[model samples]
Target: MQQDTVLVVGGGPAGLAAAANVNSAGYKAVVVEKEDVLGGAPILSGYAKLVPSGEWAKDAIGRMVKRVEDDANSTVHKGAKVEKLEGEAGNFTATLTNGESVQAGAVVLATGFTHFDSINKPEWGFGTYEDVLTTTQMEQMVASGKIACPSDGRVPERVCILLCVGSRDRQIGREWCSKICCTVSANLAMEIKEISPETDVFIYYMDIRTFGLYEDKFYWKSQEEFKTKFVKARIAEVTASGDGRLLVKGEDTLVKRPIVIPFDIVVHAIGMDPNADNPEISQVFGVGLEKHGFLERAEQYTNTCGTTRKGIYSCGAAYGPETIDDSIAQGAAAGGRAVADLHALVQKAG
Candidate 1:
């Protein structure tokens, strides 16, 4: 017999939104999360204030987790993953790693993207120097209410944020932009200034893509109000200075000259990469992956969230680098689509 349930993989913002929507539609939602907690990168990485909304990741994503957990129709499996999927649309059985089997009419893959590892680009001084950190690491520092250097307890007088650490670089083979890195870096700059007013923040970038509403909100506001410096430059490498400070070597494209700047701290605005488990997810769910290793969408226009498999849908960063708000919206849409399909199947059976 077909079940009135939707199986949602991953427990990030997108997965929570999908489960909540499904439960609201009077259908059961089985959420399978590999981690013990419901929240994804934001909670796992300990993010501070999110972009656009400016809400704390815990509060924003916490509400989503609460919504899903409160519903009686929703069943969440923590520290478990869907090991195998059998059967077909409207009659699917998913075996979990935790020894649970869920029967569902549809599935929604909301597995999010992974943060680009800064270790791959060692010249940037991530693993080499404790003062050099990723955006996520900086966010953790901001959340902790401290902006001191990891190497030493001293507060940094100058911090340089290098944009597109693992993005738009043919050498790394990550040609796609990570979408939110620019705006996020701008927001981070403002936050750093707010915390430590005396510290000057410089952002080195190829292009400032604040894009649409974020231009005035994050990029322009950061420069005008917070005095965050925006430099059009290509960073070559980050090395140690004679005096123990970090030297950022790069070319100022605007002036057409190479320059080496010294900074107390260097921040790498890392990009988003395809989920590490995309291969396993593709194999278990019988779905296809696009060239970038993200879950392939069946059709962009007609089936916005549908995967290669008929009863399985996908949304959020699983498709590509997506914003949290967009991911939630896509998750809700995918949930609605799955519910509608299930309803149609029920009608046909009747």
Candidate 2:
């Protein structure tokens, strides 16, 4: 068993950041990631391509990986998860299925999150219609340098974006904004128009969320400036015509009329929520979880990472909805809190 370390779980933006911060504090850190590789959500987060910055999440996460690998006080475990964690506070042991356990003074949970599967709504015709694709699939297509209609292999003349398929609807269990979908979908719409100027793009949304700095400008630019069609309605279903085209049926609430539009390709910009199995992690640490299964702290203030159980801390998506910047900041904070907890324990022992 490895001794005298902080076991930072999950190796994405938050986990790696926590490890980096803890190591810099003169304490060793061990990062346990379930996947065979690091980078967390951004590992598959193809190309929402960073906003205002014009960089992708993949590029930014790459930089974080280098920092952690180069640090001597940090050890990375790919394809490893703590099947069992024992003891508490100043002395804890995490045993992996590989029959290895590590002794650590502190723990930080940064497990991150997963995306919604848009195909659950068969009416959207995700798998049924070759012209229909989910946001992640669209990201992959964009990254792969191809945007042809999946069925006909021709440059799409009309591309439609369907919003809230897996988000903000009571029919399905996922009923949250997913925080980043609106911006990402809007960003992609503009990018698509830029790439294929001849292609007509339409964005269907219930409400255009334009929070934070200059986000409204982005929404406006995509709608009015870029001439992307903005339809305020809830799409009921997406079907395919006999000729390999797609048909979308929705209610245009603004005009209060039922509308059916045909397009060469349709993209589903689904929303996201907490991971399904996050409750299992919460139970392991004896921490409180929000109704949505995200880790819940003491309040909105002092107990962010601190759990009901001492010596344990949680951050990033393990806690709740937050952006990349917020997650990194919390990771660094969690490291400080944990090191402080350990320093006090050492002082007591001496």
Candidate 3:
């Protein structure tokens, strides 16, 4: 007989939420995480404050981790992965890397996304300059309560944030927008200004996309209250000046003029990429990958979280780039759906 359990792959926000929901639905949840610890990118990457909520990542995602771990119906296997999946629908056998096997009624894949590496675009000066940093690195600095240049440890008088790094660029074949970069950058600008009141923050963007409610809270607030400068431009390259400052070469699209500006430090608002383990995941789980390489949903309208294979579901960044709040909600939806479907299958068999 198959166990009344759901196997949740990954230990990120989505996976944890899914497991918690499954446990609440009176079913067991077996979470398999490759990392030694949980919390996924937010904790692993050391994210500072979250968007909209402004809560520290550790505090917010930590609660999700705790909720699942503390539950009696939840079994967590850290530093392990699902090596192979067999059977189908309400009776699936998953062999873990640690030589354990779980007979789960359903499966939920929440293997999150990978942050775009700036080194892929050499002209951005990320690997080339000590002062140039990605948003993740900059976030660590903000968390440390200081916005100083990594090169000389000096408080930068001027800082430039270049948006759309590794996103919406046909040259790199990453055409989809990362979704959260705009709001995050805007919020980061305010945080930088708050920490270093004397520092002037400039955001260079092709388009400012603080969509929906974020328009007023982040974009406009950063400009109106925090006095952050928004520039309509496309950066060409970044080079070091003789004086050790960085020179950003770009065109001011508003004025249709070429410009080069010097800044003490430059930041790249990096985009999200598909998880690096996607190829291996697809092969192991027998799930089809969408055109962009994210797990393919069975059908968008009827089954929002259903994966290509039956009895398997996917949510969060595994489907595409997603916010943490949305990922958690989707995880719950997927978990509830899987449990409901499992019940229906059992009733049919009986």
Candidate 4:
């Protein structure tokens, strides 16, 4: 059994950051990542740019991955998933899909949130229409250096982004706002305008939620210099026109009138969904999950990284929608908590 080892699941920013801190504290940390590569969504999704900074997303996340990879006390298992978790607190055993079991003193569930599937909302015509894409797909398009209409392969003349596609909708049973979608959509709008200056980008949103102090700058610039249009409305449906252009139908809430606009492409600013593996991970680790399926924290006010179970902790999107910086902060906090818990466990055994 590996004493003083912390099992960090999900090799994303949070998991990597946690493992790095654990190593810093003179502990061995094993990171089990379900993907072949390290950086999670930001890498897997091929995000061209990161929010707030406009720096290359890959460059920023790559540095974190490099640190974890170089750490002597940290072992990263790529393309591995946690199949089972047994025991508790100080003496936990995690069985991996790759037919390996890791013994650890604590566990940190950083299994991040999955992006909401835009196809689930059929009215948006994500799958049916070639031009209708999710924000993630749009990110990919931007990364690929071409934001052309899929149907015609032409740079779009007009682009419409529909915010809050799968979030804050009572009809879908997901009534919580995905905290990052607004900022991400706004950033993408500016990115699109920067990529193709002639492209007129319109964002149809309920509200422009640039929640933090520094993030509001991007939103302001999008309206000012980028010439992005903001429409206070939710898109009802998207359909293809006779000429192969997409038509977006919605009610302009501000004017209280129904409007249909034709566009070259429509991007669905989708929300985050609970990780599909959350139920299994929660049950295996004996941790609780929130109503929205994010890993539940021990206490909202007092304890930040502690989970319902004593030796188990959670951070990053596993808890909820959080920025990359916040996820890393929680990762460090979780690392500190794991160190304290393990030290106490060792002392008791001694």
Candidate number of the best lDDT:
1
- Judged by lDDT relative to the true structure, which candidate is superior, 1 or 3? 1
Off by over 4 Å in 3: 1-3
Residue range 207-234, candidate 1, lDDT tens digits:
9888879999999999999999999996
Error of 1 at 168 (Å): 0.8
The per-prediction CA RMSD against the true structure, in angstroms, equals 0.8, 2.2, 0.9, 1.3
lDDT of 2 by residue, 107-226 (tens): 998888777777678888887877888877787777676678877689999998888877777787765666666777777788788777888889898887756863765787788767
Decreasing lDDT order of the candidates: 1, 3, 4, 2
List, residue by residue over 1-350, the lDDT tens digit for candidate 4: 55679999988888888998999999999999999999988989888788766778899889989998998988989999888898888888989999999999899888998889887899999999999999998999888877799887999999999999889988887788888888888889988988899999999998888888645577777888888899999999999889999999999999999998999999999898888888988887888999988899999777789889888888999998887778888988898889887888788888
Give the Cα lDDT of each candidate: 0.94, 0.80, 0.93, 0.89
Candidate 1 regions exceeding 4 Å error are none
- What TM-score does model 4 achieve against the real structure? 0.97
What candidate 4 gets wrong by more than 4 Å, as runs, is 348-350
Question: Candidate 4, clashing residue pairs?
Answer: none
- Count of steric clashes across candidates, in order: 0, 0, 0, 0
> What is residue 219's positional error in candidate 3, in angstroms?
0.9
lDDT (Cα) of model 2: 0.80
The TM-score measured for candidate 3 stands at 0.98
